[model samples]
Every structure is written in C-alpha cells, then in structure tokens.
Target: MNQPHHRPDPYTERPWLNPAISPFIQIQGVTKRFGDFTAVNAVDLAIYQGELFALLGGSGCGKTTLLRMLAGFETPTEGRIIIDGLDMTEVPPYERPVNMMFQSYALFPHMNVFNNIAYGLRRDGIKSDELKRRVNDIIDMVELNPLTHRRPHQLSGGQRQRVALARALVKQPKVLLLDEPLAALDKRLREQTQFELMNIQDQLGITFVVVTHDQEEAMTLATRIAVMGAGQFEQVGTPADIYENPQTRFIAGFIGSANLLSGTVQDCQPEKGTDDAPDTSRVQIVTDEGNQLLSVSTDRVVAAGDAVTLAIRPEKISVTLQDSAVSDTADKVPDNAPNTVSNNGSGTVPGYVSGNVPENVLWGTVQEMAYLGRLSTFRIKTDAGPTLEVTAPNQRRVLDNRHLIDWDDRVRLTFSSDSAVLLTR
Candidate 1:
C-alpha cells in the first residue's frame, strides 16, 4: 500500500494547523436557513490573507448563500464569522469592512463611470479631493480613465465589469468578495480578465473570495478551491490536489470525469504472492475475470469481503491499439503474474483486445469520435458496462485514426492500478 503523503512542506506551514493565527477570514460551523429549507448546512472554512479562494458548485448548492453570509448580506443561523481577528456575528453590511461585487454589475444608470465608482466614498462622507484621488487611482488601475464620462449603457459588458471590480476594490476592505465576476463577459474577454484579476490581487495583497460555477475558471483563478455539494463543502484543496487525488466517489465524479469500477475485496498482500501469508490485515480488490487483486494503499481500515469502488480519471489512463505487452512500471501495481485474464486480451476475445496484454485491460468498441481543437474525444462502448470517454492529443496535421479503428471496431483500454483509486464509503 502506498502511504498517503500528508507531510507538510518544510518552508511553509499548513493552514488548518494554526486556525487561530492563520486565517484572515474564518467561518466556523456556519449554517444558514430560510423557512423550512436549509440553504447552507454546517460548514467550517478559513481563507488566508492575500490568497484567492473559490467556492465552486452548481446552482442551489448553497455556494451563493455561503458567500452572502461572508459578505454580511445574510446572517448565519449558527456559528461565528471572524474576519481579520474581529467577530462579525452582529456586524451589519455597511459597517463591516467587506465589499461584494454582485453578479449583475449593479451600477446605477443615472451615474457616470466616475460617480459610480466614487459612490461608496461619497456615501462615507469622504472629502471631494481625497475621493477624486482615490477614484482616479482606481480608474487608472482598471484602465477606465478614457471611459470616465461614459454611462453604464454606453460601455461594453466587459468594460462595465471592470467598473464593478474597481468599485469593489476601492474600499480597501480586508476581504473582497466577488459573485461570478467574469460570468457576464464573452469567452475571450473572460479569459483575459482572469489574468487581470490575478495581477490586481497580487499587487494589492488582499484576500479574495470568489464564487464561480465554471470548473475551468475555478482551476485557473483559485489558489485553493472549496467544492460544495448539498449545501456543504465536499473537499477543500488546491485545484491540482483535488483533481489528482479525490478522496470520495462524489468528489472524483464532480471535480472531473472519472471511471468508477466496482469490485469485491479479496485477501491482502504486501507484494503479490503474500496473500495467504499470516500478515493479512489489509484489504485487496478482486475483479470478476479471475483472481485479479489490487492492494488498497489508504490508511483507512478495511476487512476482507468488503465492497469497494475504484475511481480513475480518464486522463490518467493511456489507450493503445497495437499492444503486445508492456511492463507495469508504476510501483502501485502488484508484482505478480496475471492470475486473471484480461477482458481485452488477444485470444480471450478475438479482435476485441490486443495480444498477451495485462489483466487491467478492458474491451470496448469505438462508437463515436469528436475532434476538438487540441484533443480528439472518443465515446467507446465497453463490454464491462458504461460508455467510456477517452481523449487523444492532436500533435500534427494528420487525419483521424478512424481507418485503423472505425465505428464498431473493437479496441482495448489499458490502465495501471496506480491510476485507479479505491473509493470507500
């Protein structure tokens, strides 16, 4: 079993270790409810200073409600919200040192670009000269100096979004909240604005909490992501951490596309042949073909005869049409001969699998193919059950590989045990 790598980096400290001194914003056991429905369940989270954090989920998942609670637009039913070492449980929206950029770009139609951005300062009774300096500095920062006199209707959608961002950051709040900041912009504009937002955050060194439903946007923008589901956070980690090492079945399926395989736990072995030895406290997974077993590497205790689910992302798996036999290079795979026959092996199923393959291969037929700009997607129908989604890179100016394997042509999908994760519930 491969040990779970939980050791912290020597240069930096882990956030959860020192919750008292680590967080610029802390939501401890926070819950929100309206009428009989609970929009947000009990959730505990912390956002460090000068970091970009993303709360990502689909609609009605309480991600919006959680953001509202942090912005002081909605009060929590239980628990406390502490920002910058100040308990804001009883703080009102206007009094708290927090600002939120709404999704709809709530700029007043009667107000021009300068007045709209200067509205917050004017309301706070700041003198005209200071307000002018602050507003001009922000206008220069957002590159809206040329469009100062333009109204909301006169500007493009992306320009209006920059105005809203300028207004949100003008207050110099310790925590800045953005609700779907780039949702209104076009695809190209959104992509450009992501880098702009990142640059602004780095320059100002302010903590940013953004809410986004776009997975790609979250992966790009967030230093750490809190993936929400059913009004609670499923997992909180870096985008790479969450995508590569999902802890649960729902997390594996939600974060990205994953292939889930169900099997029964067999005898545990350190290597391959030690299954019947005396030290057999660990659990092993067995496939249907024969005595094919995969060791469970997690620290979670499991017994023999337990049912387990293996989750593997499509990108971790590599597919080859012309396969004789390749060595299992990953240490995660058991070191032993094939006790079980591969469903896609050459002689076991004619024309379905390649010859003398490993036991981890599966047989499938290519039903459909789609050539995206950078990658080609394949919808393969596997005999094991469901339709598998596979991707191949387009390296050069070459035609599709349809001549080698066309519609209804069977193929093999081979992956190692390390690529697959054992999901225990």
Candidate 2:
C-alpha cells in the first residue's frame, strides 16, 4: 500500500514564509546607544508566533543588548517594540507579557524547588490553592517532581536549571527569553538539555527568544537564526539557509567553516526564465589562485571584471588521490597556470591531460588530517598558494592505523559549481 506524502503546513510550521500572517513580535527601527558607543544600530525584525528564534553572535556584538530591549530592560534609543499588537517600547520589564531566565539560573538559595517555582505566583497575590496547583503542574512539566523538596544548594546544575525554568514558566508569560540557558551545563548535559528545552517550548507553544554566542547551539536550537555583527544583524534566516547561502564574507566565515577565495568576475550568463521569476546568473570567477570557479548567484548582481569572493564549505569538497598515470604531467603544470574553459564549458588546467580531470579541480598535498569519529578533515596545501580544507565521511571502521588517505600524500580536490557560493560583499 502506498501512503500519501504529508507536506508541511506553512501557516503553522513556518508562519514567516506566509505573507498573509502578521508577526507576533516586531522590532521597528530599534537602536540602543550607551555613552559614546552604539550598542545596537537601527535594526528591524519580525518574529511570528511559536517561533524559537535565536540571536547569535560573539561577545560585544549587541545580541544581549537587543534582547534586553525586547525584555524592556533597556529602552530603545530610536524605535519601537510591538508584541502581540501592543507597543512595549516603554513598558516595564515586570509588566511586559514576558519572562526571562538568566544565564546563572538565579535560583533562590533559601528556597526549595517547589517554593522557587511558586514564588512568582505568590508575589502576584494568587490564592494559595491556585499557586500550589500551578507550581506542581509546572514541576511535573519540567520533570522536577522528585526534586521538589530540594533546595538550590542540594540540587545538581541541571536540576537547578529546571527549577529556574519552572519558576519562569509558572507565570505563563506570552514569551520566554533565555540568556544562554545551557551555558552552565557540562557538554554532554548541555546537549541533552537542548532537546528538553525544545520539548518544553513545543508543549507550551510559547515564543522563545534565545541569546547565545555559540554558533552550534543556535544552529541546533533555533527555528531561525539572526547572526549579529558589530551591533547589527549580518544575516537572518533558517539554519540551513544561513549555512548554505551566506550573504557576505563575514556571515560565510561566522556561521560555519568556510574556505574563502578572492576573485574577479570573468563572465556572467543569465538563466532564461519567465519575467515574473527571480533572476539567476551563472558567474565565472578567476580566483587569486589562478583557478577558475563557477557559481550560481540569485540575490546579487554581478558583471564582468567585478571583484567577488567564492565561499565553499569544507564538507562540500571531495578529496581523492591524483591519478598515478598523470602524476608527472600534473607536476609539469605551473602553479599559476590559467584554467581555460573547454568546449563543454568546463574548466581545464593548462598543460594537464584534458578530460582526465573535472572542472573546479585543484591539485594539492595533504598537509594535515584529523580523524573525527564519523568523518575526517584534511588540510590540503594546493600547488597554488592557498590551503583548502576538505572533510569526508569515514564509511567503515579501520582496525589498523593506516588511513585511506594519509598526510603528505598528493591529492586532488573537486567540488560542483552549485556547492560554491558567490559573495559580492
């Protein structure tokens, strides 16, 4: 029996992609300045309901500042913040429909887990019965029932984190703001807790805004990520989108590992399409290494002679030992030999045996290698000046120390044109 394929519902699974739906949180022209420095420039963003959005960047990149503004801790110098169709720019932190869990957890040392979770409801003057009900319900949700009687001092780091999370969630705020929520846990526990946090967010269906400096954390936890740089947003998109199609060199280098090559546009061939469809151009780039590269560009315009950069992910590159038959002929090719386009529109290195090698291929020697359990990373120092990084999966277990490819061995690196990203900036 054949089952029908279930397509994703864009309205529920990805509201941002649907233009008809309104944003749940809108930051309009928001900026924050302190003394002589601008912590956050004029930034605008829209977050839909039930999104687990992440603000990702390094320290001093203004991710925290922007989050504080969202929490009403810092007033925006020049814009407005709207949450659920209400202006919250000037609203007090306590009055806003949001709860923030600090990085330190900030559990009350004198209180037990149950009391800590109930403190918010108590302070709000809820009835004793209702407070107990809410506290117990949240404790069960976070799976802290066994540790309900334990104080912060008696609980483990993960337990205390759950207590703080229950405390914040007991109030049932419309949005939850987490400041490096998993920073305090050990590596193994942090990875474990990431799924827990996501599960809690899913059960509650609350919009969660997380601020973190760790790229892997953001990429793992966020439904969408906003990469910050120098008090402004460098790029904003899904983790896959940000990783696969970074807009600039900064984003290309920041989001993940990228091998960047400076180049000049040699030619541009626009793809034929309907007038209403977006324009796409196949760009030919002559890199500084004298290797010609081809990439598809859809977002930016480029013409002949324009300077550009080609960004390639290490995982996209394949490494193979150079053919023994052409070893001597390959060595005869100059380091700076031009890659001329063959009749089939593929690149061929001058002085090398034609048809034996594919387009966008570079000859190099393995300078370094790292075996990372599931995959191996290689640093290949090309015959040209640059060293390119390539990663390949280890398909089978090796009982001996000998690897399929070893250090100091001559290798050829090749990647498809679609794997290379064209960055104009």
Candidate 3:
C-alpha cells in the first residue's frame, strides 16, 4: 500500500512552531510603571518574521504601552527588548528600524499627499531622483497616484488613510507599528480597508504589530493574536485557537458571547490513550439550578464535586417549538413533556423534529425575538432558571407572521455534546 501525500494549509504555515527558527522580535520580562501605577506587567512574547501580530485589549489594557515600547517611545521599567539579533532597549525612537502609523493618520495639512509621503525621505538626505522613485513607487502600491497632489484636507477618510500608509512604507522600515490603524474609518470602509492592509502587508513582508480593541479586526487581520487584560496577557494564539479553546472565564466571555452556567462536576470518564496523544475525558456536570449537562472528549481534568462552568455559544444551540399542540398558556405544557416532537404541521423549522433531544437539552419559553434580516436572535427563559440566548437563521422568506416562532412559545433547545466547553476556572 502507498501512503497518501498531504497538502499543507497556507494559513497553518506557522513559522513560530519551528523551534530552530529564531524569533524576529522578542520581549523578555518587559514591564512599565508610572510611579505607583503599573501600566504593563512583566510579559514575555515572541514574534516570527513576516508575521502580522496583534496586541488586543480594551481601554487602559497596556496594549498601547507595549506598542510604544516596541517603537522605542518608552523605555521598559524592567527587562530587555530585542529586534533581529540586537538589544534595542535604550535606542531612540527615530534610530530604531521601525515606523509607526498613528491612530490619527498624522498627515501634514500644509503638504499635499506627495510631499507628505516624501517628507521622511527628504529628511534622510536621499537624492531628489531616488526620493521621487521611492515615494512614487509606494504611492502607486497604495493606489494613490491620481490623488498625489491633493492636500490632507481635500481627501476623504479612506484616501487620507492610504496617504498615511504610503508615508509610513516609503521609508522601507523593517517593522511597522500600527496603533489602531483602522479605528477612524466607518464600518463598511473599515471592513474593506482591512483586506487592503492585509494585501499590502503580504506584498511588503515587513513584520507588523497592530494594536486594536476591535475583536473582529484582529481576527480578520492577524496571523496570531495576544489578548491582554489588566497589564497581563490573558491568552495568545491564532484566532481560531483563542476563540474555540479559551483558557479562562474572562477569555471565554471576552472574545465572544457565551452562555456561561455555573455547575459542579458529577463524574469524569477518562479514556485510555497513547503517551504522545492528549488525554480525553467525558465530564457530567449538574448546574446549581438543577440542570444536567454533558461534555464529550474534553481535555480538561476534573473530579466529582469540582466546581466548573459550562460555556456554550448562542449559535451552537438549536431551538424548535416544543409541540404544535402547545397554546398561548406556556405554563400548561407538562413539566415532563416528551423530549421529542413531530413537525406540528408548521414549516418554520423543518427536519428539526426528526431526532431526540441530546444530552445537553433545555426546556424553555421564548421570551424575546429580534429579526435582523439574515438571522433572528431569541432569548429563552429556561425552566432551569437561566436565560439562554439562541440564534437561528431565517432560511426561507417569511410570508406570514403566524407560522413564525413567536414570543411565549414553549421551545426545546439542544446542542451537541461536543459543542459545550468545560471551564474549571
């Protein structure tokens, strides 16, 4: 028998995974303090070459402070900063091999787009011909050729952003530090510019370190993300790694919305495995409110009586009417109603009634509903004394409101055993 050849995934080409490859930028035990206030805690980080890394956090989370340190704007109160193979702890801002794009594009009002981009090259004493070639090449790369003569005041928000980017890139720095680069644009333009930024970064291959509070921006743009909280790194990994397997309760709630329920572990069933493979366990949890949930193939270890939290995303849940016979008076439905149901003749959610409820099922009443064109969000008041949010897509056009899953309807919620994450923190 012949072995099959495996094709590599482009997104999974992680240089950081190879231990022999040295880090392009390294921050070892870096910390910053202002009098009694500690802005950044002692944190260690490694950035690979040509990687688009993001420092993500909310207001006052030390992401900006760390970015400034990398740019040589602020010296660390403790620890060292290394770029390539040199220690740059005390290097001045202008002397470092990095360029920073401020949140406010920072284009000169008196200079047109061309002069704004050429300003840095002129200060470096480049000859006129070489300066013009570099500046025009960058301008063309950013698609700002026709607007080169326009001043900052005459350009729209998106065009001004391109000018700022062109100015930053013309100097040909080894690294680019962007402090909330896309924060000023409106929603649609911001989304569009994110792709443009990615394309330019791919073309240049310069290491980029971005600071942003927007989760979606970081997820869409970064090859890896470092989620910070209160002067410390909460977690650092690829977008999918951080989102799917959050290490803490704060991370589980911060990256996205999760229905967090407090519970106690009822038992654990650890499966046998080889030494090289990760150990797997099936955990049974009973909520404080008397609801039972099961998590399958979880990697976390927990014994009976250990307190834990079960996190389930809203989109992972499936909701359907309990029965077609159920009436306006939801309380009339039997407490021990059958866990399975027929279509009830309503076409709202077809094929949803064909299976029995999974181990992670809840009986609830639809308390609220919001139709937002593509999908509808529902807040279900579970009989277990918790309000669970469920989102369902509107697959077919709604011709009549009568057939829709309305408010106060008795509903059953089910999720796959693997969908629920077990968090012991």
Candidate 4:
C-alpha cells in the first residue's frame, strides 16, 4: 500500500468530505442590513477547528460586513452566530471569544511594542511574571522580539503588522478575525508574510477567519474559501475546487481568467459505457458564433437545444503555428485529454472557410501581444467568433523577435473537450 503524503496544504480536501471532525463555528442562515440595504444575506456555513478560512469578494460584496458581524462589532439583522458551541449573536464585542485585527494595524504610536502587547494582557488581569511571560511568548511567536523596545513609528510596516498580530494573539482568543490584514504591505512583503502567517496559525492551532479581496492571498492563506457576491456566498471550496470546477459563470470569471463561449446543446448520450469506467454523458454543443463545435462530459441530463456555455482557462488551450495541419478528430488528441479543438480548421472558427476544414481548429490573427516575463499573452481577432486570449509560458529565453508570436500573425489555438467546462448558466 502507498503511504499518504504528509502535510497536505489545504488538508486533503473540503471539510464537508472529511468525516473526522465537526464544525467549530457555525453561521446558520445569517443576514445583516444597514437601513434598507442588506449587507449580508441569509448564509449558512460551517468552519472547522484550526482552519484558516477566508471570506473573499469584491468591494461592497459583504465580506467585510460578515467579518464585522463575526467579531461582534455588528449584530446580524437576522439569524444567529455560534462559535465554540455557544451562541454569540447578542454577546458584546468585549465578551466574545474573538479578537479582530483591523486593516490599519491600529498600533499605539506612543507605546512601544512590549507595552502594546501587554495592554491586552493587563486588561485580562494577568500581572507581574505571568503577564511578562505571556507578552514575551507572543512577541517571540510573531518574531517581534527585536522591536520590543521600539515605538510603532520606529517600526516598518511589516513589523507594525506583526506587532498588531502579536497583540491580537496575546489574548489567545478562540477565534481571530482579520480584516484585509495584508492589504497595506508591499507585494514582496505580502508574499513573504503569507507563509509566516500560515506558520503562526498552524503552530497556535487558532481558528483564523480572514477577509480579503485578493484571490491569490485567499488561495495561499486559507484552507477553505467562501466566494461572496452581492451579499451572499456563491460557492465554498478549496482553491483547486474553486479554480478548476467553478459552479457558476461569475465564479469562473472572478476566481481567474476564463474564456467563455455561448452555445446550444445538440445532443447528450447519457451513461453509455462499461462497468470498469462508466461513460459519463457526452454533450455536443454548437457555438452561437456559427462556426464552432465542442463536446464535454457532464453529469447533468439535459435536453437538446438547451442553452449552454463553454468555459476554459487560457493555460488549458494549446497555441501553435499553423503549418502542421494537425487533424481535429477525437483520435488526434491523447485519450487523457478531453474536448479537443484546434486552429488548423481554417473555416471552423470565425474568419475564413476552406475545402480542408480541420475540426477543433481556430484560425485567428493576433490582434495584440504582451510579452510578460514568464508568459506571453496574445489576443486574437478572428473572422467568425469572439476574440480569444491565449497565454503560453516562455520556457526558453527568446533572443529574437521571430520566436515571438507577433501582432497580426495568423496562429492556431487548440484545446481538449474535457478541458472546457460546459455551464448551463
């Protein structure tokens, strides 16, 4: 038998699928409003113990509002909040078993690091040797030992952030709520602090609820992400699940860059194969653009003529020069690949039609090009379909312009059927 891999990043899979633990925090049908406007809708969620959970969304999307409610700064206009098996809806912010770290870091300008950290310890009535030990322990935990005697203004932005973190953690609350905790730091510092924050969360085993609009931050910091839209959660899953298998068009577009093509289903062959590898329903969709055909494997049973959408990420599609004249049949692609499409099919995509129309091939002229350091991104304007954006890594250093896919160059884009997701929405 194979040994299981140690230290899985997101902890194997979604918490719902794991049978070992129950929810440590529960928000059952929670909603909040300011005047007539609803900031948070009726949302049901469960967060397990020691989880680095993130509430992600765009501005005015209710993520910060939800964090405020969780921290007892704002009461839910409807529903209840429970943490560590106790109802916290009406509990005052001071009494709640949670500490909030604001976006500003909110350090005391006059007080030095040690005093700031000790403020909370003193408030909790811990005195003398015990207080000093607790403050020292937390200061060391956040790596702010050297700055213990320095004032907030004397510290760098990152050190101030660490001090704020130390202050929040010194209390050792059951849950920590951070509102855009890393927003103020520079990109490089933010990236470095991401792992540092993750490590502290892991060592302390404290449940962390972070709110961020940055997708990469959420992906890197949290075990689970709840994508909020219009005051409600659209989907909750691990980073892979949210990126690879988004349930809605908004999610596909929001989580990452996606190419969306509208189409209509021509037919579906439901459950047709064998015992060992059961055949999933094969859906053949004709693009509304009138020149494309795509097939995908889906679990849903839908009738012909139903409207559908084909969603694929840029990296999933293969881009190449047109001289190969590769065929686009099912056999052309590897068995492991799905929904194969190509650019060699001259008439198949938008602009031109010819006698030898290759299947799954799209012919387009590069309208724009951007040579990003690690990747080259191209925007193609075709004669028949919508413009497509394709990105390919610069594996080899390009010394000459000839190696690059220049503007207005006729290039071919190919992709597997299974690589594209069929969405009814």
Candidate 5:
C-alpha cells in the first residue's frame, strides 16, 4: 500500500514520493565491468511499484548498462537484483518477468505491425486466437489499429515507436525497461509522445524504468529521477527535488542553469518566533567577489567561516535599467550586509519606478540579449569582471515599441536572499 501525503503532483496524485512506501525494486551493490572498463560501479537504488522512474545521465554514464542489468541482458559482476520478492540475478532474458524496449525499435522490416506485436506470443507457442486477441488489444490501447496492416518500412518514426511500445505491452510484464525510447522521433512527436507513454503506464500500472539523456523529457515524464555520473548515482529524488535542491556542484550544473558563486558562511541567524512556526534559520555567505549573500536552509548545521556555494537560477534574478545618477560601479556600492527583496506595499520590487538604490542590486551593463518569445535572456557583465545571466519575462505587451532593459543598457540586477540556494559541497 502507498503512503499518504498531501503534496499532490500533476503526473500522479498518489504520494509515491513518500519515503515510507516499501520498495518494489532494489539494486544493491551492483557492479559491472567489460575488459578492465568499469561500466557500472557499486550502486544502490530503490524503486516503488507502479512508479515511473528515470535513469537520467549522459552517454556512457552507465544508465543503459544498469537498465540492461535489470533486463537480464548484462550479468552483474557482483550484487543482487530483487524484484517483487524474487531474485532475478540468474534470470535469462526471455525468462525474466520484465520487458525491454530497445532504443532502435528493432522491428522486423518484413513483418506488419500486428505480426510484430504478436511475434513474442507466437514464439511462446500461443494459439492464433489468443495471439490475435492480444495483438488487437494492444493495438487499440496504443491507438495503432489503423496501421496494423502496415509494415515497419511503411510506418513513420512515431508509429514505429508506438508499435514497439505495443509489442512490449502485449506481454503485460511486471516491469518495462525503455532505453532512450523516444530518441527516434522528432522534437514535436517526442513531446507529444511523452504524455502518451505516461498515460499508458498509468493505465497499465506497471513499473517503468526509462533511460534517457534528455533532461526535459526526464523532468516531464518521470515520477522520480536518478541522476547518474561516472557509473554511480550522484543524486536520486523527484524532479523538483533534483532541480531545486541539488546536493552537489555537478548536480547544480547538470540539471539546469545555476549561477554558482563561491562563498563562506559568515553567520547563522535563527528566527526568533513562536514554537509553531518552523525554526527557520538564515545563513549569510560572503562571496569571492567580497559581496555577501543570504540564504535560508532548514536542515543543515552550518557555522561561521565555513566555505559554501550560493546557487541560484537565472530566472529568479530581476534586472531593471538604472540611470547613471543612481547607478555606480558594482564594487563602489556600500555593503553593510546582504539585503533581501522587500514588498513596498505595492507587492513589487523596491526602486522599480523611482531610481533608488535598492537592496541586492548590482551594477552591470548588458552584453548580450537573446530574444526568445515570451522570455528574454540577457548576459550582463558587472564592473567586478563577472558575468551574471538573467532571464526576464514579457508579461505586459508594449504597443509603443518600448523595450524593457534593452541592449547596452546599464542595469541593476536584483535577486532576493531567499532565491539563493546554499550548497556546502
């Protein structure tokens, strides 16, 4: 049974994110090698039943090798793989209670869609009546009934992918392993197919382990992600956790664009409030540029003079054009302490209308601008010889050809102390 939690997510309303649920798949001390090359190191993982898990990493990062281990294609050099209270360490490819959909969609060119999907069942010596019924059911589920008569060569890339999926689903395996399943399709089809795959998994209630290098796809389709690197998992959590609260420097840079600034914790200020409220503590970090940043961390025992890193995303920082009278060199600004964002009764950043020197504002000149529709990315160079990337949204339309912090404009980039993420590693 699944545990109860209030954090309802879009992908699945079930609280599989709760750690209390018993694991359905466990990989313990698993290692693999090929000709002195360590493809996979000793890694431990736990995946719950009916969960869509993503093994996310770059090429040669051991994601596929791990999936192959789960599929019984690659025998582990040392370790145990348990699934549904059964040990599958010595299981063969065809005898294992799991199915693997290869990256190439490995369909027979001469066989039609129905025959391709029924080939497995036919190989098992099932009669034509049962095989025909199973093929039709999977074809209907995958919405490929119209293309059942078409051969692999006659089908499109997306169609071929669906055919492969239908073939894997026809057997109703306890777990389905997909290796770069959507890599064969174009961008448009891949985006549309991701949700389709998710819906099918939800309906079937089978645990899915997908290996993919595409971070966005992993974020979109996976219930939880395991970020792998150098044959070991760097981090494993929900997509939100991996992106928002990255543990290591590699995770911060690998998941998304993070502005990592070196700093040291100068102080830890605990909030002085009632017991009902969380014991929220704010840590102050002084950057290498001699500027300090404040961050809120709940579960760390931090101290003064401890080196740390302040990681913040690009979208969280706000940039506004400041006139020459109020703006000066970046280092010239007085810094008593790092300042956070404040509400000026209008619920907007201070000094948005008037040219007042607001807190957390830094002087910089726009060096480059990328005009993506609905969003604009600017590369701003500070007077202190550092470049901070800022992304601003176009919420309001301008009819008079007005630009908000245009090219070559001297701007003051502002970010709240709460936006700063403190990473000790």
Candidate 6:
C-alpha cells in the first residue's frame, strides 16, 4: 500500500514539449465544445511525418473527437492545426490531403473488391484506365487478388478490412486516419493484422494516425503514443519512453500498472566526487529504504521538505521468499549516518542488514493465482492493505513456484529502490 504525507511547495512547470525533432503536425491550444459540455480542452500536440502515431484513452476522453478534428469532420472552437506546413484551421475534409477510415469499415455491400477500392478515384473523376491500374495495384498490395471479385460479404472479416484499407490508400493522401481499425476482428486475427498493418505502413511511407482505447494495441502498433485524459493529452512519447519515463501519476497509472507511493522528501543528497552532481539527487523519499533511498533527477524546483509521489512498475520489482538467499549487507546504518561503502553488486548486491535479511520485504498472502500457459499471475494481498499483482514465468515444471504460492499462503515481496520511480503527484 502507499503511504501519504504532506509538505508545502508550489507545483512546478509541466514538461510535455519535445523540441528535439522536427514536427510535421502541430496543434496549439485546440479545443472543442457542445452546449455547456466541453468534449476537448485546450491542448498542444506535435506529430512527425512518416510515423504511426496512436491516440490512446478510455471512452469519453475525446480521442475520437481529436481525430475527427484532424480529419476536418469537426472544427475546433479555438487554436490552430498545421499539417505538412499548411494551416488547416478552416480547410474542408475533401480539400485537405487527408483520408479517414471509419471504424465500421463502411464498405458498400453491392460493390466488389475492385470497385470498392476504386470508389474514391471514380468519384474524383479520374481516368478509367488509371483508376483500374491503381485499384489493381492496391488490391495486389493488400494481397487480395484472390478475393478481388468477391463482395464484402463473400470475404472474411480480415479480407474485408484489407479491402477497406486498400480503398483508403487508393487516393494516396498525404495523411491517413484510422479509427479503431482492428476493433472488429477477433483477438487472433487482430494480433495478426497488427503486424500486417505495420508492414504496409512502412512500405507505403504514409503518415498514419490511429485512435484506440486498447493500451496493448497502442503499445504494439504506434511509433509514438499520446495518452489522452479529460480531453487533454497527458503525455506523448514512444512506447518505451511512455512506459519508462512517465511525467505524471495519470500517465504512470494509465500507461501500465504502477505502484505509486506518496511521501515527503526528508533529505536531498547529491552525488559526491562526481562531475555530474547537478544532474542527480540522493533524496530520501520516506522514513523507509533504510536511509539508502533511490536517486532521482529533476529540475522541478523541489526542496528537502516537499510532497511527492514515487512511482514504480510491477515488473521492475523482484520478489523472493523470506528464507531465500540473502543478497546485500553493506548499508548497515550506525547511529545517525549512512554506511560509507556502496552496495554495488555484480549480479546480486551484498545484504544491507549485515548478517540478516533487510526489512524491505512486504509480507503478503496469495489471494488468487491465474495460470496463463507459460506464465502465472499471482494476486497477493499485503498487510499494507493493497493487493499486489505479480507475474512469475514458468520455465521448469518441477521448479514452478505456482505450487508454492497457493491461495492463503504467506509470501514476501521485495524490489530495489533503483527500479522505483519518483513522481510529484
């Protein structure tokens, strides 16, 4: 469970800008409202070209509304949107070089695959021969040559999705918008189609933006993700960046399962005998961690006595039984000072409590166990009052801990402070 404490300090500046790279699409203070309800708040965003980006959030979070604004289906009440150096504030959907694929796959049941792929071209008054050539090329690109003559009902769900994609790409727009493109397929087909979509996006080199509520799907498909909440972007970065370096509690909790512990900073010890003193902090988060608190880096104007939240991911934690092998023992606090020697382990750090195991372990009872073939998930209810979720992989059937961690059995969970993240809220 998380412990809470209080301190006095004004909130610092929020860091959401990434000015390291060139931006292809820019949105400044964009907002949308209807009646007395606001669907989208004032938000700033930057999206690069030739990138597969995802807007991820739960329903009513305005992800779909943001996408519709980009596609010109809805106009923003304030701010400006620039795509490929053109101001798109008032540009109509048809006039803009953008195409959107609806979530429903809105294909005509009466039209064959060829005609479906050529519908946009024919509506735009393209020449017959060129339209046929482009339609056939896209049909072959999607690997739908065998089903080119089949209507929407004649093909499988996956094939029909491909046909819809082919039609969307037939116009060769500068940017493509996909709205929950894989939400209709079954789990197995959706997994397979994700890879196919990546391959096609790379091969075509068109900028693609997908809106989804599925966290795993966004992590798998997007080069970068914008996690939305309350109609605003909480954080935007690559899948790894969003997972590892979340800027807020919302991002930390929304992106993955994180353990957020709130406390007051007791001390700030900088790295001694190092040139990088200003970049790191040896801050004590709470009255825990045995005076060897984790180091965190930030320029958020924090002092020794301040309120903050330390966020840590579940997988980063290491669990062991109480009687298991003892690892570290170097940091034995004597009186008021910390131990002089560092517990830098080659593989396993030396024990901290000298000859005894440290008191960092949390005792818990396994409340539930779910075996998912190669790995097992154990939900343990700790004495701290929060249920901790732990995933243990099953390598050797004989060595499986699943048998040891039965319901109501006592277990100990421990993890290093370095694996834990420190946050402000």
TM-score of each: 0.83, 0.90, 0.89, 0.88, 0.86, 0.82
Ranking by lDDT: 2, 3, 4, 5, 1, 6
Can you give the lDDT of residue 334 in candidate 2? 41
- Runs off by more than 4 Å, candidate 2: 1-5, 273-279, 291-299, 324-358
Best by lDDT: 2
Give a tens-digit lDDT track for model 5, residues 91-123. 998888898898999998989999999988887
Across 185-268, the per-residue lDDT of candidate 6 in tens digits comes to 999999999999999888998889999999999999998899999889888888988898888999889987887766667556
Instruction: After superposing candidate 1 on the true structure, give the runs of residues whose Cα lies further than 4 Å from its correct spot.
Output: 1-20, 270-284, 287-299, 323-359, 383-386, 400-406
Off by over 4 Å in 4: 1-14, 271-279, 324-359
Question: What is residue 131's positional error in candidate 1, in angstroms?
Answer: 1.3
**Higher-ranked by lDDT: 5 or 6:** 5
Q: Please write out the lDDT profile of model 1 over residues 1-425, one tens digit for every residue.
A: 23336655522434544545567898999989898989899999988887799999999989999989888889999989999989997798998899889999899899999999999988799877999999999999999999999999999999999999999889888888999999988999999999999999989988899999988899999988999988999899989878877877888888878877667775443433354333323345664433344433444456667787767677665555422223332212221323353545333421112234332555567889776767767777765555667776756544655444446766666665445677775
For model 3, what is the error of residue 36's alpha carbon versus the real structure, in angstroms, after optimal superposition? 1.2
Candidate 3 stretches with Cα past 4 Å from truth are 1-6, 9-12, 272-277, 324-357
lDDT tens per residue, model 2, 1-425 = 13325755656778999999999999999999998899999999999999999999999999999999988899999999999999999999988999889889989999888888888888789977888888899988889888888889999998888988989889998999999999889999999999999999999999999999889999999999999999999999999989999999999999889999998887787876556556677677767664545454454688889989999999998887766424634444443453444547445424223244433667788999999989999999877557899999988785687888889988777776667899988
Model 5 lDDT vs. the true structure?
Answer: 0.81
Q: lDDT values of the candidates? A: 0.76, 0.85, 0.84, 0.82, 0.81, 0.75
Q: Where in model 5 is the C-alpha error above 4 Å?
A: 1-20, 272-280, 290-298, 323-359, 398-402
lDDT minimum window of 10 residues, candidate 3:
345-354
Model 4 Cα lDDT, one tens digit per residue, 312-349 = 89887767654443453322332233222344733343
Arrange candidates by TM-score, highest first: which order? Answer: 2, 3, 4, 5, 1, 6
